[model samples]
Target: MEGKLRLAKKNLNISLKQKPASFQTSSPELTEMLGMKLAKWIKKHRVGCVVFLGPFGSGKTTMIRGVIKGLTGLNNITSPSFTIVNQYAKGKMNVYHFDFYRIKNATELESFGFSEYIDSGLLLIEWPEVAMEKIPPKSLKVTMEFLGLKRRKITIGFI
Candidate 1:
């Protein structure tokens, strides 16, 4: 485990070592490590809004699910593509998953109290380009890219 973590850390681009925490990952197990780190952040900071940007088939959804699985008691995590949004409860907090792929306009999210969700629940938005103008400026961004079959490079850009 230590060796894998060291390799993962070595492969990452340290943009802000001065900041509390940051990481970049290039393999599936390494990606899971990054998710664990973010899980710790969520536990410590209570983050509500997060945006994930990446090309198709880059495993963004997979990483998010891994994070949710690692989260204690967050058992109902699922892709929200069909319903547009899926809410999962973890103890007293709520995690809202949003998929904007089918959304023709940003206004479509407004009717569902998008601002209110951003204000209150932990939101994981996929295909966030459509509502990029509306998302909070401080939201954490995770971008993923295809490295090869069953391989991915995930970079976390925190704001």
Candidate 2:
């Protein structure tokens, strides 16, 4: 069982390296539009996890709000900074949004039933550096960087 599992994991990793998709958004509307496109891709691909990396005020939360709107048609969304996690339901699909900025260690993740959330629904993680080692191998990684006051360069790839 272990050998088969390892093989399957290896194959999945190899498959993810096919190509990466990237885009640049100069305004909040453009960022949200990109998020909506990502939402469609996520649903079509049945993506399980996504890790968001960006500096503070880089619009990570805004992108997430767009994703929620695309997935569940929910317009109101907020960052889970203090709360750590937020769960949303849209018919049969469940989205589990997590913020690890406050986490001190991997043990903290385990303490809060992080593993359970991974298997329960689609995961969108912000500030994943706190527990980078614990993130699943198949997760999609999104990196955002500010170009100017409102422009952002967003890159999406598997890592």
User: Quick one: best lDDT, which candidate?
Assistant: 2
Against the hidden true structure, what lDDT does model 1 obtain? Answer: 0.68
Q: For candidate 2, write residues 65-152 as lDDT tens digits.
A: 8787889998768889999999899899799889999988888888987877767888899998976777877788888999999878
The model with the greatest TM-score is: 2
TM-score of 2: 0.86
RMSD values, in order shown: 3.6, 10.2
Q: What would the TM-scores of all predictions be?
A: 0.78, 0.86
Give candidate 2 misplaced runs (Cα > 4 Å). 1-17
Off by over 4 Å in 1: 1-30
**Candidate-wise lDDT, in order:** 0.68, 0.79
Summed backbone clashes in each candidate are: 0, 0
Residue 11 in model 1: shift from native, Å?
11
